[model samples]
Target chain A: MKFAIQINEGPYQHQASDSAYQFTRAALAKGHEIFRVFLYHDGVNNATRLAVPPQDDRNITQQWTKLQKEHELDLVVCIAAAQRRGLLDEDEAKRQGKDANNIAEGFRISGLGQLIEAGIEADRLVVFGD
Target chain B: MAKKFLFVNRKAPYGTIYALESLEVVLISAAFEQVVSLVFMDDGVYELTKGQKTDAIGMKNFSPTYSALGDYEIKNIYIEKESLDARGLTLDDLQHLVWEDEDDDWAEKDSIHLVSSKELATIMADQEVIITF
Candidate 1:
């Protein structure tokens, strides 16, 4: 089975991102294919490279980046939501005339269309949020 | 077969980014040509209420975007009647949303359906995919 995941909350503030991560990992362990993971709303913050956790704590952004690298996952951040919350990639930051870009590795900025496509293409669409 | 996609909105507008972000997904889902329906329940009913002014709050008022859902071929928009009553609102308080019915002599038809919570639950059960925000 192919699964598509939607994350709607940011890290630390909500358990949504963690639950989504666990679910994805478990699905992959069971040999299920992950179609895509589309971030929206506060979830876009999960893709920011600027997030830094304490030495003892687990870094959420790094977890996602690692998962993407190992699984070759399609991790997408909604462009509109990212713009509203200031999570920009290099191209978007330059286009918007910003000084810096913070999008983490393995995640690309895209539109909500990717989300809808995931719903249509994946066998199951799982959403985690507030 | 096109899957029945039901977007469940339980949050209020503006207080959080959920409402606005959910609308973006709904609009984009139209392009997939899926059987999409939106249910406004709980605080989500406030999303459809009229006369919203966000300039005072310094946030862009995106309420007008609800009216454009019809243009995207999304016609099954349901509002929980209990939610509206609990919030002291009625159909008159919401923006008038309509779509052109090609099967009905091309007449304009109201798109918003006032349904009870029970009815909304049944509608939810029939959906192949249910995304809540």
Candidate 2:
């Protein structure tokens, strides 16, 4: 089965991101194909490269990036939500006249269309949020 | 073949980004040609109330966006009747949302449907995909 995951909350403040990560990992372990991982609302905060956790704590952003690198997963951060929360890629930052870009590696900023497409293409669309 | 897609909105607008962000997804889902249905329950019913002015709150008033769902060919919008009564609201307090059915000679139809929580639950259970925000 193919799964598309939607994360709606940021890290630390909520357990949504952690649950989504664990679910994705378990799905992969069971040999299921992850169609896409869409970040929306506060969930866009998970794609910021500027997130730095303490030495003992798990780096939520890094975990997502590593998963993407290993599985070649399609991780999409919603552009509208990202802009509202100030999570921008290099191209978007330059275009929006911002000084810096903080999008994490292996995540691309796209539109909500990607989310709708995921719902249509994936066998299941699992949403994690408050 | 259109897949059954249910958008479950359980959060209130303005206080959180879920309502607006979910609306964006609902609008875009039309392009996929899916059988989309929206249900507003709990505090989510507040999203459809009329005369929402965010000017005093300093938030962008996205309430008007709900009216545009009809333009996206999205007509199956269900509001939980129990939620409305609990909040002391009625259909008259909500905006007049309607859709024009092109296939039916452009007949104007009410987009909002009032259903019991049990009925909404049944509707949700029948969906192939259920997305909540």
Candidate 3:
């Protein structure tokens, strides 16, 4: 199966990020193909490279980074959501007159149109929300 | 072939417009002779609870709209079993009829299959379109 998952909420405030992670891993383990992982709304936080959780727990950012690296997943964070939340890539940071970018590696800031295209193209688009 | 479409509702009906908008979409899709299915998950399952008092919000209660699904031939309504159990709700308490995840009643209702999240994933993969609210 080919799937697209949408994450639409923040990490700390909701379990959406965790659910997305679990679902993605499970789908891949089942030999399913993940067409794309689109992050929108507050979900863009998952793409923030600056996020650091407590040492006692699993770091979702690092986990996602590993997933992206190992599986070559398309970690797409919505550009509008990223800008609003102050998460910028190096290019976007420079364009916005920022000193540095905080967006993590393996994640690219894109437009909502990509989400629409994935929704139209993918066999299934599962949404994870709070 | 009529397209099989599923609307996954994840929010409450009142506080946000997502629930209401989802209902509208289901109705519109049904009108087009599409096989529309509604799966209420998480907080969205609360939308079907009976005795809703929208009067506090100065709005008419819209739960009744769900009861009219039969008139529109949109009878495939499903609520996640885990969601209901987590919220301490039962099928009898909802405004409209809903089958549980393990319920065999769906088979009696024809091709409408009440399913678990695992089955939902497979069903979703089979569908032509899926929208999340």
Per-prediction TM-score:
0.95, 0.96, 0.56
Please provide, for model 2 over B19-131, each residue's C-alpha lDDT reduced to its tens digit, 9 standing for 90 to 100.
88888889888988888889999999989889998888898999998888898888899999999999899989888899999989999999999999899879988999899
> Candidate 3, which segments miss by more than 4 Å at Cα?
B1-127
Chain A (candidate 3) TM-score to true chain A = 0.97
Ranked by TM-score, the better of candidates 1 and 2 is 2
With a 3 Å backbone cut-off (N, CA, C), the pairs that clash in candidate 3 are: none
Writing each residue's lDDT as its tens digit, candidate 1 over B18-88 gives 89878988988888889999999999999988999998899999999999998888899999999999989
Per-candidate total of colliding backbone pairs: 0, 0, 0
TM-score-sorted candidate list, best first: 2, 1, 3
Ranking by DockQ: 2, 1, 3
Query: Best to worst by lDDT, what's the order?
Result: 1, 2, 3
Model 2 misplacement above 4 A: none
Writing each residue's lDDT as its tens digit, candidate 3 over A29-122 gives 9999999998876788888878778899888888899999989999998786688679999999999999989988899988766765666667
Worst 10 residues of 1 chain A by lDDT: A49-58
lDDT of each: 0.93, 0.92, 0.78
